[model samples]
Target: MTNTMWVRGVEWLAAAAADPRACKREWDHGEGVALLEAGRFWDVLSVPERLGLLTLDLLWRPGLPVPGPTLVDTAAGRVGFLLPPDPSGGWVGSGLRCASRGSWVAVPPPYRPARYLEWLVPPDGSGTLHGPGALEDALQQANGTLAVLAPLCGR
Candidate 1:
């Protein structure tokens, strides 16, 4: 079944991309994660969608290395992506991969505005962050949270 929340998130991203101010304020990694954790952002996207957003965020950031590996913390785990390396030293945009999964997934070209919104947040709201090695712990915590919030989420 298609996830309605993911669809809504894509719509939100498209609208934000059309407005420069909205894009600037809404697309930051930290801020996006904050909103997701706070239930203010869509959080039902698939893992691939989440990775796609992370890759796009890196591309949008100024002065960040492109076509390289980057990692971020999420409620799921420490996800990573490798933006495809530029060819001829020119801007060659492509897809990325999540380190946790190690699978290359294609993203729409940067010119396109169908980017996914960030939905990965720290497992807990206590400001303590975990990494790839903490996957098991994260899963346990997530299960606990799900048990409590599933009803609230109408799941």
Candidate 2:
């Protein structure tokens, strides 16, 4: 990547950091990843990888809206979607998790892959995020589809 493109990517990813300068410093020092505190610029909602992938597909359908930055932790088999800070706590049950108020997420540095984390949907740096309602709907639909397909897939 050219310097301009790399800078742009970093500019967007910096929105997630508790200290954008610290994040940039780590990357500048050759770190591939940083631990970003949640609930500072955004929160996170994570689901099992299978369900999250399906949810992403639904969210990206032609008539639907694309979600904000998303990350998948290959080692942990989890997918996390960034949401606006202080998301609805009602969505906390049913194997779903919301990382806010003190939680942290392992994030890759801008367009690059980290140890076990990669961006599924990179942020645009425009402060856009997944709406709680839309995410919930898509997740429910994905969960239902997975439940139906599990037996047929023999999983």
In model 1, where is the ten-residue run with the lowest total lDDT? 36-45
How well does each candidate superpose onto the true structure, as a TM-score?
0.24, 0.87
Q: What's the number of clashes in each of the models?
A: 0, 0
Q: Cα RMSD (Å) between model 1 and the true structure?
A: 16.6
Candidate that scores best on TM-score = 2
**RMSD after Cα superposition, model 2:** 2.4
Off by over 4 Å in 1: 1-102, 107-114, 117-130
Residue-level lDDT tens digits of model 1 in 52-154: 3443353434673322222333433434332222222221122322222222222221222223422232111122222222332333454455568769989
Which run of 10 residues does model 2 get worst, by summed lDDT? 86-95
